[model samples]
Target: MTRSPATPLPPPKARRRLRETAALTQTQLADRVGVTPGTVRAWESGRTTPRGRKREAYAKLLKTLAEEAAVQAPEPEPKPKLEPESRPQPQPEAKPQPEPEPKVEPEGKPQPQPDSQPQPQPVAAPEPVALTPAQAFDALYAFSAPALVRQTFLLTGRREQARESVERAFQTAWEHWPEVARDRDPVGWVRATAYEYALSPWQRLRPRHRHPEPPPADPGDRTLLNALLRLPPRHRRTLVLYDGVGLDLPETAAETEASTPATANRLLRAREAVAGRLPALADPQVLHRRLAELASNERLRAAEPPTVRRGGERRARLRTRAAIAFTVALVATTALTVRTAPTHYEPPVSPGQAVRGVPQRVAPGALSDEELELRQKLLDQMQDGPERLSPRLE
Candidate 1:
């Protein structure tokens, strides 16, 4: 007869769970397994594995505990099902019945009879058509670009930069259409990109942006914009995402790449700054409304999809060309350095002194017979040049 295979032990974590589920302590399990408590701890932590008779005993105990745990595990709630969909209802048995005598109709009246026919089945709805990449990109851009631009405006407080930021972000999305389309939230992807670009630290280095743009005509709006610009970038981003964009704290933390507590700290500080500047606008709801109004009131507009796609293609081509050029230049520079570099060191030649000056040497005039003849011939050729070569075409 063939022997049965030995049962394998569960994982380290599962071992601890099995022990706990059985209401057994490490020491108790150690005694049952014929080992010390430290050995049990090591086994549970995956630091060591039991062997020989000990291994079989431990496995057997774990198996029993696992069975108990399975018995104690709660079952999932049952799903409600439709009778027609889930299965056909049980039909009642047919029985013989006494036939009633037909009544005679008076003067040209016809008797009615019941119709025997099965009801028609319900038809399922047709599946929706999947979108092409270009079409999907167009839809995403048309839906989100305008509002994304406005949100970026709130972040940077610049109408021109906000429009630029949104356009750049959309262009980036078009370039990576496959990845963006597969993303769970394409809108969020574009929004995050636009927000980061709009608030980039390098943007401050531009000469035109050295000073703040002209303030809004409304004093209230001007105060709010100034207050937002005054706060640090992280604090402002957290506040805008949490309050302005209506994102929950966890989402805001995730997008900002900060811990929940840190994000909360930033939001609190930002609100205090804005509230300090404008006392009447202390409530977060009011602030959110004001930010929306300020963004909507601007004349910001996005370029069309075709324009954005072309721009993205152009930018990509430019980058590719630049990379090629840089590589060629680097190769050329390396070749030149290698060719011109001295392989061996040489002592410098000392300048010859007068040595009480032997009479200064003189040479003949620069124009030799061949040089004079060549110079004369060139002059004659210029004088006899064709009229087409004349300075005046006429």
Candidate 2:
């Protein structure tokens, strides 16, 4: 019997390690392979695998890249040998110094005793748990979901929208759990994703159902939250990322998709707007404290696990209906306005003018004094009176 070809390497681990070794981001690798970033992510996360020509191409590309990397790697330089003159020399033995004698204390004077050695403080070790992919996702969800939902709520004034955005973001994280688990700042990644999702323009177009009113909060907090919602979305998001989420300026800028200077300007303008609404916010410490309290409250709330089945189809259907309704209403309004609008600038004609298709003018010489006086009065009325001229009969 013919021997079977050697089994292929596991694609997921090989693809991830190869991409890392080549210092290529998922986006970069996707670009090189002429595929979408999501496809690469799915492949790395084991959600899907490359097949047929694509598989062969992927394996070939990785092998070529690994070879190029190995060839381009720099050789290690050899260490220099030490010379006899540079080596440490042995020294002749020296005589030991005499110990100083302690003086005796005088009679009736108390002698000083040596201090007792301080005991070492015990250090608490971190819990050691090996995180499988599922466990890691669970831990991240437990830690970050509530806070992310709250952050999204502050960004989008609607509580339901905020919850939806957070859920979608977390669902994405779960899809790419392997990569997210290996990320340096998984929480930050999820938070940023949720923030972007909350701010998506498509979300604004979707028809929203009414939600139950929230429980009573501090009047001051309500005032501040209302003011925050009134702010431009960019400014509000920037402020929340910096103050509420405690991200540094650069991180906030990155999340907001703004330059550092622009982000700084937004933050400054947001602060001023808030201060204008709430005088207490003029004090930086007071502003910071309030934001911290809001964040703490959000963190303390319970979080539900994200829905396993994403609501993409439902949202898409709703969006389509909304678009159709908007279009129909827009067309109807335009038609109504056009139909009712005044079509011509000229006033209605008298019977004589209608028959002649022109206005009949009287000569000054043909007019009686009364008629002339009446015409002059009409002219004066036209120039100064508030009442408009009415059409006359012939």
| lDDT for predicted candidate 2 compared with the true structure | 0.73
Which 10-residue window in model 2 sums to the lowest lDDT? 299-308
* Cα-lDDT of candidate 1: 0.83
Deviation of model 2 at 288, angstroms: 2.0
1-394, model 1: which lDDT tens digit per residue? 9966666878665787688678787789889989987788777655468877888999999988888889999988999877776787799999989887556688756577676698999999999999887788888889999988878877888888989999998999888888778666688778878888888989988886977677788887787888888999999889889888898885676567554578899999999999998987789889889988887777888889888888999999999999999999999999999999999998899998758758878877788899999998787774756556447566
| Whole-model lDDT values for every prediction | 0.83, 0.73
Name the runs in model 1 displaced over 4 angstroms.
1-75, 79-127, 210-212, 340-394
TM-score (C-alpha) between model 1 and the true structure:
0.59
Runs in model 2 lying further than 4 Å from the true structure: 1-129, 209-216, 295-394
Query: Model 1 clash pairs?
Result: none
Q: Candidate 1: deviation at residue 135, Å?
A: 2.0
Q: Estimate TM-scores for all models.
A: 0.59, 0.46
Give the C-alpha miss distance for residue 81 in model 1, angstroms: 9.0
Residue range 1-394, candidate 2, lDDT tens digits: 9955543534454656677678787778888877887777667645566876676667778888778778888988999999999999999899999955555676756556677799999999989978776666767778887777777877776677777777777777776677777666788778878877888888756657334436327776677778888999899989898888788885675555444578899999999999999997898778878876654554234345533323433555677999999999999999999999999897888565335567689666688899999999888875665887699999
